[model samples]
Each structure stands twice: as structure tokens, then as C-alpha cells.
Target: MLRFFRVIAPAVLLAVTLAAVFWGLAIGGAADERTLLDPGDIVRYGLPLSRTLVNVSIAGLIGSVVMAVWALATDRDEYRIAMDLAAASAAVLTVASAATIIFTYIDVSNLAFSPDASFGAGLAQFVTEIELGQLWLWELLLGASVTVLAFAIRGRRSTLIVLIGALLTTLPLAQQGHAAGASGHSQAVNSLLVHLVGAAVWLGGLVTLVFLAKAVSRDRLALLVSRYSTLALLAFIGVAASGIVSAWLRIGSFEDLFGTGYGQLVVIKALALIVLGAFGAVQRQLLIPRIATGERGGWIFAWLVTAELAVMGIASGIAGALGRTATPVPQESAQDLVGSTPAEFLTGDPLPPELTFSSYFTEWKFDLAWGLVCFFGIAFYLAGVIRLARRGDRWHVGRTIAWLIGMLMLFYTSNGPFNAYEQYLFSVHMLGHMMYMMLIPLILVLGAPITLALRATAKRTDGSWGGREWIMWMVQTPWSKFITHPVIAAVIFVGGLWVFYFTPIFRWAMSEHLGHQWMIIHFLISGYLFSLTMIGIDPIPKRYPHPFRLVILFATMASHAFFGVTVMTGDALLLADWFGAMGRDWGADPLADQKTGGGITWGIGELPTLALALVVAVQWARSDTKEQKRKDRAADRSGEAELKAYNEMLAKQAERDAKVGPRR
Candidate 1:
């Protein structure tokens, strides 16, 4: 049974996926003959089929690397087999991406195969000049790179690098297809990327586990399965959440779920997810424990896994068809821009209502990527606290409150009116930047999350990387040492502001979604590192003395205040094309608004700076008190021996001075 399952399970997955693809194509009319520029039924049907291969291959490629890094030991057969699977999957991804690129061009161009120069030139132009074509070409290149790296890389750090490359192959997919449209474009792309990666890891990890069934000992297999269950749980959460966001963006209304073909396909996919989730619960609750305890044999586990993979195949195929099906809500937002203002035309969204005090709290435009980060940040921190508490360990309540407040601030900064109005208001954007780079990090560092995590998590003995192991590795690395230094951290904190605002980076952050996200991350890290160096309770290679910390703080504060003043006093507008051309009829004028932003930068920043200074002063005072207490305790222990020695030295010094006076 194990041998049969090992050989035929993957084949089963492939056959079911293809069959489901054709079935979905039939239901959605994606394979119907086009009235104009029909590329023939072969191209119409072949495109979705090839996409299924790409998706499955991606699952295999990414999943194997995740398993190898998180669960399987490097010296074991399980780890070796997982890497081999990654290599094979990456090779498949390369060919499938190539096929997808060709099929996509044929579908788009409606041109028949030919050997003529014009045809070759058109094909080359599509791949080189067009956005969709460029994306696919990049995917192909990334896949090919992963294929080579997966075979060559074996060390833990090297495998992680290869894994990152493997994941990069999926980014192009997120930016293309229906997700490329302007309306809710960022949300759609973010949600779809989240869904793709989550499903890939969850589905691919299980398939890899099935293959490992025959290679590893039963007990070892059970242990690996247990480790994988944690990944599956996290992946499930991400997939489920992102799927809802994706569906809402496309379906628009609950009624569409029952009415539209696209919505029906979503229903089918959702059902498959439910079934797969049930399979995960069974694996975690019933099968794994029983198998580990010798109550259930490994063969039963193999059959159950095969069934799970078949279900995953159905979901994967349906998802591909959903991409091809016409969405109930129009994916393209260009038509809505017909009579829009310059603001709408440029920002791709309507100008928000006039900024008000209440709007800061009431208005919201969710950022899915950062929303997920904040959610998981608080959830995991709370979970760690709970685990520690259950074990009769004490973590400060103040720390917990500080962490929650920081995460809440993070969520609000990304999703609240600050985000909604940032494109329109330079002041609001600058305010959000202040929170991201200073206030949020100040609160978060006080939480001492690294210290909490180190205290909370158990040390892993296996040759696999877990949360605790990875954290320790990050802290102790040479790069970490260099970055966390007071001087370097101060430089980054102070210098980054000038470089960002003065460079094209400011323009990119304003106009591009990915660039905006990167801006937040870069500033947040710079702030965190700076705060960590100054007042963080977390362990580090070194920290400056308290007086020196005061000096660094004062220097950074002066530079920050100078930057704000510089912006306020400058006559020229930054990103004149963007902020100047917004055509806002409400609020301050562009130049005036830019000045307001500078004022905000200068004004709102002082509170955190003062807080940092006070904390440093308090720590210094406590350090002195502790030193005096140590000396007093030593005097008590030694019965004032040091004090008597001091007096004896003074007496000898006096006698020597008298003898010298007599001589004079």
C-alpha cells in the first residue's frame, strides 16, 4: 500500500487536477470559441491546463524548501528527498512557466503558429515590451534560477536563500491577470499573493510528506508530520483570510455566490478548503497521535494523505479557472476614471472627504499585508505570554499592554485615515511616517519582545530551525551586531529621513504600492534598531553607556528637528508632479501642506524624544543607586575594612608631609 501510494499519489493528483480543469473550463465558458480573433479551441483549453501545472509545481517547489528548513534534519533522508522534490518541481515550474508565457501570448494575440519574421518579432515584442509578457518572462527566469539553486544549495542559510528565490517567482503572478486592474488593485494583489503562498505551502508540504512516507522510519515520519501540522495551521489561517478578501473584491455581494459562475467557482474552492481543513484537523488530532503511539499504522496515514491531495488538486484546478472566468464585479477600474479629477486619475482612487479630526479614527482603507502583520504580531505575542503563564512563569503586564498598543498603532497607521489621506495630504503622510519610525517603535521596544520570546520558547535540539532558533540566530549574527550599534543605528535613524525625502524613493513611495510597503518596513526597522540600542531590554552584543546614550539621543533629536525645519523653510515642493498636481480643492495648498508636514515632523517628534531622554535619565539614576548599594553591602560584609584602610593611608600621608615640612 505504501509503495503504491508513493508512486501513484502524485499521478492521481495530476490526473484529477487536469480533469477538474477541463470541467471548470466547461462551466465557466473559458474554453468557448471566440467570435473574433479566436486562437482556436486548443489554445483556449490549453492555457488553463498549463496554469494548473504551474500552480502545482510551485506548491511542490516552495513546500519542499519550507519542510526542509522547518522540519526535516539536514543529515536525514527526509531532508535530502525534500530538496530533490524542490529541484524537480522547480524544473517543472521552468517548463510550465515557458509554456504559460507562450500560451498567454497566443491567447492575447490570437495569432496562429508560424515561422515568419514578423511573427517572431511580435512574439519577442510581447515578451519584451508588454507588461504581462515582462512579468511572465521574469517568472520563467526566477523558476530557472530556483531549479539550479535547489540542486546546488544544501546548507541551512543557503537553502533559505534559495527558498526566497523560489518565492520571488510567485510575485509576478500576483501582479498579472485580474489582480492588475486599478480598482482595489493593491488589495487584490496582496490578498492573492497571500492566498497563493499559503495554499502552496499547505498543499505542497502534505504532498512532500506523502513522498517521504516510504523513505523515512515510521516514528520519524510521525515527528515530521507533527512539525508540519504547525505550518499547515498557520497557512490555513492565511489562506482562509486572503480567500475571503479575494472573493469580496471579485464577487462584491453575497448574492453573487449563488448567482454568478465566477462566484460558484469560488464556492467550490471554498468547499474544497473546508474539506482540506478538516483533513488537517484529523491529521493533527487523530492520525498523528495514534501513529506516534503505535495505535495506527503508517499505511492508514498514507491513504488519508492521498485523499487529502486529491481534494487539494480539485481546489487548485478550480482556482485556475476562476482566474479565467469573468468576475461579477468589473476588475478594470479604468472606465470609472472617465470623469474623475486629476487626483483620482493619478491616485487611482477618489479623493477622500475633507480631512477632519473624526476622520482620523473613523475612515479606513485596510492594507491587507500590514493588517496581517499586526494581527499575527499581537496574536503570537499574546500566545507566548499565555504559554509562559500556564507554565507558572511571570511576564510583566505592562510589557503586554505596551506590545498591544504598538500593534494597534501600527494597524491604525496603515489602515486608518492616515493611509486613506496620505496620497492627498503630505501632512498626513508625514504624520504616519513619524508614527512608523518613532512612536510605534518606542512602544514596541519597551515590550522587549525578543526577551519575551527567548524566555517563552523551548530550545530545539533537532537540526531544524524553529522560532526560537531563528530569533537567536538573528540576534547573534555579525550583521545584527553592526546594525544594532548605537552610532550606526543613530545614523540610520537620522540619515534615512534625508535620503528618503531627497531621492526618487519619495516619489516611488507615493506612487507605487510595493514601494509604499517597503518604505514603511525600512523606516520601522531603522526606528526599532535605534530604539533597541537606546533603551531596549533585549540582549545585544554591546550598548553605549547611559551618558553616551543621552548624547546620541540629543544628537538624533537635533538632526530630526533640523530636517523638519529644513522642509518647512524650503520654497520648492517635493514630488511636484504628485503633491503639487493633486488638484485638491480642500485643506491647505500644496506648498502650505508640505510646510504643515514639516511642522508635524518637528512637533510630533519631540514627545518620543523626551520620553527616550527621561527613560535614559531614570536608568542612569538607578544604575548609580545600585552601585552605591553594592558598595554599602560590601562594607557590611567586610566590617568596614576598606574604610579603615583608607584612614590608615591618610595617617601615613600626614606623617610623610610633617617630615617634609620639618626639612623645609
Candidate 2:
């Protein structure tokens, strides 16, 4: 069975994927020779084919590393095999990306292959100067790095870096796909990223499992399968949700589902997803447990894996083809937008309607990335709480409510009216920033997610880093200890606010999508760290006394208030080019809006700060009460032995003092 799988599984996947790619290309007219500047059929067809290989290679590399980190023990053959898979996949990715760059150059420059100085110069300029070329070149470089790093790194920590490098290689592609300035550019890019990652992990994991059949013992194999099942389930959800979003963005309307070739390909891919999802469900619910029970599950598992891979190949192939196809809704670039306004030219979207109280509730610009984060954040936290309940372990209901509320707030801040108007309104941006930095983190810290996870998750005897193990590793690390320290957290929490707004980072965050995401992450983490130091219930390496915590809070408040006051009173516009050039006709004057933002920063933070202080005071009183009760119990057990010892010591001291006085 193992030999059959090793031979048949990859062959079936490759054959089906190739067939689907060609079929999709034929339907989408992606391979049609252009009336002008035609780069020949080979360049047209070869580009998508090479990209298909790139996708498959990315899946294999990232998926194998993820499986190794999460499921397979490092000391076993399974881990070694997974890393070998990653190295091999990285090599393929590097080669395929190079081919893609060459083809892209051929298509763009409309030049035939030649080994001349002119050709070389043009090619060099293309790779060095063009955005598309630079993106692919960076991908090739990262892929090569992963290829080398994957071979040497076997430990979980180092392997994780390799995994991150592998994931980074995909970012260029995501950016490349959406850099054309699609209508919902940010959403399209984020959805594609989610799709790529989820699909890669799901498909590549199955491929890795096929190769692992002979690598581990039967009992261990069952355990690995069970672990992989969990990953597959989560990947399925991500892929499905992201697929819907991507399709909706491209197709635009229900009628286009049947009207356009791109839509048809999307439909086919969606069906493939459904089929793959069904396979995953069966594997998780039936095959895995049956195998663990020592039932006749080997053939069943092999056949199921083969079927799923074949379907995944179809989905992967169609994905590449759809990229080349024209969307039903034409991608609106700056040139395409008729009479484009300054706001549209700069932000790539039209100016929203005037800001009003009702509009604040009505306006929305959903961010798929943060939307997923919020969704999964709530889902998994609830799952942990539910798991505790099922095991008859007590969990505080207030924590659950706090966590849910926090997720809702996160969703709203990132995806609702605040996000919608932030680009145009500095006040709105500052409001969201303050919430991200103080309010949301305060509530989220109250959830004590880490503590709940540690209690709810079962400990693994194997060396694999499960949820509990990963949590422990994170909190126990020296770096984690340093960052979570009360003083360090306070500095980061307070100092980061000043550094971010006063530096070029603020401009970058405003203009670039990636920088914007990074800003959100930094604020949330900094805020969480500070909140954790003050009143967090999670176990950490260090905790200050309540009095010291109050001091830190007060100091932070003073710094924060000073920063806000400076912003409010400043005459200069921080991002004058961006905010001043927006040409918005609604709301306050640019300078006045900047002042409003500063006011928001200074004022909105007080509520959360006061809440933190109150929580700290309550905890302090509780600590004192607990200490008093403990002392009372000790005194009762000792029957006033401590008091007698104290009296005896006082008598001796008095006697010594009298003797000394007489001598004097």
C-alpha cells in the first residue's frame, strides 16, 4: 500500500493538475496570441504552467514544515523526511520562480531569446527596475534562501524561521497579483494570501502524509494522522471562506457566474473545494479513529488521500488559470477611473460620504485579514472554554464575555466605519489607534487566554509542540520574559506611541497596506504586554507589586497625556502631504482634524487607564485578604509560638541595653 501510494499519488496529482490547467487556459483565452506584441504560445502557456509548479512547490515546502513543527516528533524519521520534502520543494520553487521571471520578461519586452549584450542589459534593467520583475526576483531569492536553510535547520525554532521564510516568498506573488490596482485591492490581496496559505497547508500536508506511510510505526502514524486532521479542518475553513471572498470580488454579480470564463473556473474550483472538504471530514471523523483502533484502515486512508490530492490539483490548476483570465468586473486602475479625484488617485478608492453620526454606523470597509483574525480568535477561545466545561473544569464566565466583546471591538475597528474613514480622517485613525493601544487590549488581557489554553489543552508526551507546549515555550523564553517585564512593557507601551506618530513609520503605515497591518499588530501587542504586566491573570516570569503597577500606570498616563497635548497644540501637520492632499470636502479642516485626532488620543485613553487602575486596586485588596487569611491559618497552627519568640527577643534586647547603660 505504501509503495502504491508513493508511486500513484503524486502521479495522479500531477496528471490531473496539468489537464485542468490546459482546460482552464483554453476556456479563459489566456493562451490566445495577442494581435500585437504576441510573445508566442510557449511563453503564454509556459508562464501559467510554471506558476502552477510554483504553487505546488510552495505548498510542499510550507506544509511540510508546519506538519513537522506541529505534529511529528523532531527525533523521529518523520521530522527528517518532512524537512527533506521542504528542501526539495524550496529548490523547485527557486527554479520555477526563475522561469516565471524569464517568461514575464519575454512577455513584457516582446523579445526573443538571445545571448547578446543588449538583451542582457534589457533583462537586467527589467529585473532591477520593474515592480513585477523585482517582486519575482525577491521571490526567487527568498526561495533560494529557504532551499539552503531548510537543509540545515532541523530544530523547531530554526525550522520555524525556515517556515516563515517560505511564507514570505508567497507575499511577492500576492502583491504581484493585486498590484494592478483592483477595485478592492486590499481585500483582494488579503483574500488571495489567505487562500494560498490555507490551500498550501491543506494540499501539501496530504502529500507529506503519503510519503510518511513507511516513515513511522503504525501507532505513531495514527497519532500523526489525527494531528494533521486538525490542521486540515482549520485550513478547510480558511480556504472556503477566502475562496468565496475572492470569487465575489472577481465575478461581481450572480449572472456573471455563468456569463464569464473566469466565473466558470471559479465554480469548478469551488466544487473541488467542496469535494476536498468532504474528504477531510470523513478522514477526521472516521478513518483516523478507525486506524487508531487498529482496524482495517490502511487501504481506506490511501484511497482517500489519492482522491483528495487529485481534487486539490484541480483547484490549484484553476487558481493559476484564473489569475491569467480577465475578471468580469474590470480592474479599475488610475487610468481606468474616469475623472479620478485626488483621493482616488492617492488612496485608490473614491472619497466616502460625509462623516455623520448615522454614517459612522452605516459606513464599512471590511478587511479580510483582520476579519479572519477576529473570527478565529472568538471561535478558538470559545472552544477552549467549552472544552473546559466538558471536562467539568471551572472557567470564569466573565472571561469568556470579555474575550467575545474584545473580538467584536477588533472586528469593528478593523472592518467597520473607523477603518472606512481612517484614510481621510485623522481623527478616526487616532480613535482606532487609541482603542487598539489601550481599550481592546485591556479587555482581551482580562480574558487570560493563555491561562485558559494551558488548562484546557492536553499536554503532549511527544516532543511535538502542541498548543499547550507552544504556549509554555513562548512564556518561558528569555525574550518573552524580557518583553513581558513590567518596566519594559511600560516603556514599549508608552514610548512606542511617541516614536510611531513622530517618525516616518506613521507615513508608511498610512500609505502602505503591509505597514498598516504591521502598525495594528505592534499596537495590539504593546498594549497587551502593558495590560498583562498590570492586571493580567496569565502566568509570567515577573510581576510587580500592586503599588509599583499603579506607579507605572500613572507614569504611562502622564506620558500619554503629554503626547496627546503636543499633538493637539501642534501647528505643523505630521503627514501634510497625505492628509492635506486628500482634498476632502467633508468634516473639519485638515489642521482642525489633526487637532481633533490629538484630542481623541489624549481623552479616549483615560477611560481604559482608569479601568486598569481600578482592576489593579481590586486585585491588590484581594491579595491582601488572601495573605491575611494565610497568616491567620499559620498562627492557629503554631498556637502563638511566633508571639512568644518575639517577646523573648525583646526581653534579651532590653537586658543587653540595661547592661550597656550601667557600663557607660
Candidate 3:
């Protein structure tokens, strides 16, 4: 019965996916007279089919690799099976991505396929010169590369790297989906990326499990199922959240949920998700515990998993069609640009109201990615604290408060007026940078999250690496030690400011969303490392002496102040084209704003510097007190033997001097 179902699963996915594709094409008017008269049926039908193949193959590739790392001991037959699955899937992905490139070119360029020399040249030009072509080409190349790597690499660390590579391959596709000039463009892109990756992990992991069903030992099956179940839970949350965001962007209102073809497809997908979630809940809450206790639930678990996979196929099919379906609320509306200012055209939103003191607190521009990040960070940290408390472990309340405050500050800086105005005003950008690099990190370091994690997380008796193991491995690595060095961390923190603003990197970050995100990550990490070196209570490779740390701090402060002063006094504007050409209606003059930014660097930057110095000073005093108490304890333990020895030596010296004085 299990064998029959295994054979039937792939067939079901194929039949359902093809049926959904055709159904969606009909409903969404892909073959409408308008499109048929131009690109015709080949593009209308073939493009979405090829995209479906691309998505499924990519999922198989990523899911197999991730599962191999998270489970599948190296010596097990299932391990080899998982890697072979990854390799085979990568091969499929390579072919599908190549086909997707060709089909996408035909759809986008409205050019017929040809065999002439000019056709070859035009194809080359398309891949090299056009952004859409370049994206698919990159995906093809990444898929091909992973295909080779997956076959050759068998070590856990190497496989983990390949897993990351597979995830990165999805980014190009995500970036291409949203029009850059559309409102909520960043949010759409972010949500799509999360959606694609989450779906891949969830779908792909299930497929791999079914493939290895016979090879896995019955005893080990429960363990793999338990681990994969946790991953599925995370993936479920990610998919649900990102799906809602994507739907909101496309449908615009609840009324459109049933009113439009796109919305109807979204509703179908949502239903499939709800079904999958229920299956997942049953597996996690009921079957997994029974299986772990050596109960004969394997057959029931298998049937449930098979049903979940079938539902996932339906969702995947719907998603492929959704990619081609036209939405009633167009992402980029003509109405949006009817009376748009230059700022609106450039930023995809109208110029923000003029900067005011209260606006900093009141205004908001929520970033989906960072907002989720902050939310997760706070939730997880609090969970860790609660876990410790429930176990009768004492965790400092102060650390929890500091952690929450830091996350709140991070949320505000990334989503508040600072982010909204950063593009238009240089000074506001600096303010955001300062908070990201110095203030927030300093507070977070005080939270001692690492300490909490070590105490809170369970130790895995099994050889498989878990969160605790990975954290310890990372902290113990030579690279981590080098980065956490006081000198190295200080250099990165202080030097990044000059390197970023003075170079073309600043302009790149302002112009490109990915670069902007990288900039934030870099500053935040560097700041966290520097602060950790100075005042962190968590375990690290080494700690510097108080005097040397003070020296590093003072030197960093001086260099930071000098950079700010340079920015303030300089006549030339940094990123002259970006901030200068924003055409903002109300704000400080560009050059004056540049100076104000510089002043922020010099002036506002000092507050964090002073705070760090004060923290270091307090830590230094405490160290002295600790040493004095240690000596006092030693004296009490030894009965003041050292003092008694010194007094005896003084008496002998006096007696010898008295005898020598009579001879003199």
C-alpha cells in the first residue's frame, strides 16, 4: 500500500499542477484575443509551465540539501540518498532555469524563436544587456554550479555551504518579480523571497522524506520526523506571513478577495495552506510523540505526510498560475503617477511631510523584513528567558528589559521617520546609522542573549548538530575570535564609517535595495562586536585589560569625531547625485544637510561613545573590587602567614644589628 502511494504521489503532483496551469490561464485571460494576436499560445501556456518546473526543481534542490544537514548522519544510507536527491534536483533546476530563461525572453520581448546567426547574437545580447535575461541566466548558472557541488561535497560543513548557495539562488527570481518603481516594491520583493524559500524547504523536505522512506531505519525515522517537523513549523509561519503580505500587495482590499481572478487563486492557495498547517499540527502534536515512544504509528504518519505533500502540490500549482495572473489592483498604477512629484517617481511614494521634532516620533514607514526580524528577535529572547524561569534558573530581569528596549529601538530606527527620511536627507541617514551601529548594539550586548541561549536550550544527546552546538561552534571558531578582538572590532566599527561614506558604496547603497540592506547589516554587526569586546558579560575568546580597552575606546572616539568633522567642514557633498537630485520640497539644503549629517557624526555620535566609556569605567572599578575581595579571602584562608613571616624577618634583622653595633 505504501509503495503504491509512493508511486502515485509524483503523478498526482504533475496532473494537478498541469490542470491548475490551464485552468488559471483560462480564468486569467492569458489566451485573450489581445495576447493571442501577439505572442500567441506558446508563450501563454509554455511560460507558466516552465516556471512551475523551475520552482519545483529549485525547491527539491534546496530542501534536500537543508534536510541532509539538519538530519541524516554521514554514515547512513539515507544520507547518500539525500545528497543524490539534491544533485538530481539541481540537474533538473539547471535545465528548467535555462528553459525559463528562453521562455521568459519570448514572453517579455515578444520575439519569435529563430535559428539564424542574428538570433544567436540577439540571445547573447538579451542575456548580457537586459535585466530580466540576466536574472534567469544567473539562476541557470547558480543551479548548474550547485549541481556539481552537491555531487562532490559530502562533509557537513561543505553541505551547509551548498545549502546557503541554494537559498541565494532564489534571490534573483524574487528581485525580478516586483517592478522597481512600484509602491511597496521592497515589501513585495522581501515577502516573495521569504515565500519562495519557505515553500521550498517545506515542500522539498517532505519529498526527500518520502524518497528515503525505505532506506531510513525505523528507530531513526521518528527522530528525522521530529526534527523535520520543527523545520516545517518555522516554514509554515514564514509562508503564511509572507503569503498574506504578497496577497495584500496584489489584492489591495478584502473586497477583491473574491471579486478578482487573482484573488480567487490566492484564496485557493490559502485554503491549501490551512489544510497543510492542520496536517503539520497533527504530525507535531500527536504522531511525532507516539513515534518517538516507539509506537507503531509509522503507517499513519506516512499517510498523513503523503496527504500534506498532495496539498502542497495544489498550492504550488496555484502559485505558478498566480505568477502569470493579472491582478485587479495593479502593482504600479497609472493613477499613482497622474500628479506625482519627482520624489514620487524616484521613491515610489510622495515626498514625506517636512521634518519636524514630533514627526520623528509620529511618522512611520514599516519595512516588512526588518519589522519581522525585530519581532522574532524579541519573541525568541523572551521565550528563552521564560524557559529558564520555568526551570528554576535565575535570569537577570535587567537583561530582558535591555534586550526588549534594544529590539524596540531597532524597530523604530528601521521603520520610523529615520528610515522614511534617510533617502532624502543626509543628516537623517546619519542618525539612523548611529543608532544602528552604536546605541542599539550597546543595549543589546547588555542583554547577554548568548548567556541566556546556552542556559535555556536543551543539550542534544544525539550526534546531530542543534542550535546550541551550532552557536558554540561559531563562537569557538578562529574567525569569530579574530573578529571579536578589541582592536579588530574597533577598527571595523570606526573605519567602516569612512570607507562607506567616502567611497562609491554609499551611492550604491542608496540606489540599490540589496546594498542598502547590506549596509545596515554591516554597521549593526560591527557595532555589536565592538560593544561586546568592551562590556559584554557573555563568554568570548579573550578579554583585553582595562587600560588597553580604554585606550582603544578613546582612540576610536577620536577617529569617529574626526570623520564627522571632516564631513561637516567639507564643501563637497557625498552622494551628490542621490541626495542632491531628490528634488524634495522641504528639508535642509543639500550641502547644509551634508554638514548637518557631519555634525551628527561629530556631535550625536559622541553620546554613545561617552556611554561606552562610562560602562567600561564601571566594569574596571568592579574588577578592582573583585580582586581586592579575592586577596582578602586568601588571607583569611591562610591565617595571615605572609604577614607573620615578614614580622619574623624584621626581628632577626634587629637582633643582628644590635650585636654588630657593639663591635663598631
Comparison by TM-score, 1 against 3, better one: 1
Of the candidates shown, which would achieve the greatest lDDT relative to the real structure? 2
Worst 10 residues of 3 by lDDT: 28-37
TM-score of each: 0.96, 0.97, 0.95
TM-score leader = 2
- Candidate 2, residues 429-471: lDDT per residue as tens digits? 9999988989999999999999999999999998788999888
Q: Rank the candidates by lDDT, best first.
A: 2, 1, 3
Q: Local distance difference test, per candidate?
A: 0.88, 0.89, 0.85
Stretches off by above 4 angstroms in model 2 are: 292-295, 335-338, 652-664
Question: Tens-digit lDDT track for model 3 on 1-664?
Answer: 4566556666676677778777776766664646343677787788888888888888888888888888777767787888999999899989988888878777777788888887778788889999788888999999999999999999866788789879988988898878776777777888898899889999988888888766766667778888888889888888999999889988889888998888888999999999999999898888777764645566776777777777887888788888888887776632356876666676666678899999988899877778788988998899999898898999989999999999999999998998888888999999999999999999999999998888888887666667777788888989989999999999999999989987889887886778888999998999999999999988888888988999999999999999999999999988776788778768778999999989998999989988999999999999999999998898899988888899999999999999999999
Clashing pairs in 2: none
Worst 10 residues of 2 by lDDT: 176-185
Enumerate clash totals for all models, in the order shown.
0, 0, 0
TM-score of 3: 0.95
lDDT (C-alpha) at residue 259 in model 1 = 91
RMSD (Å) per prediction: 1.9, 1.6, 2.4
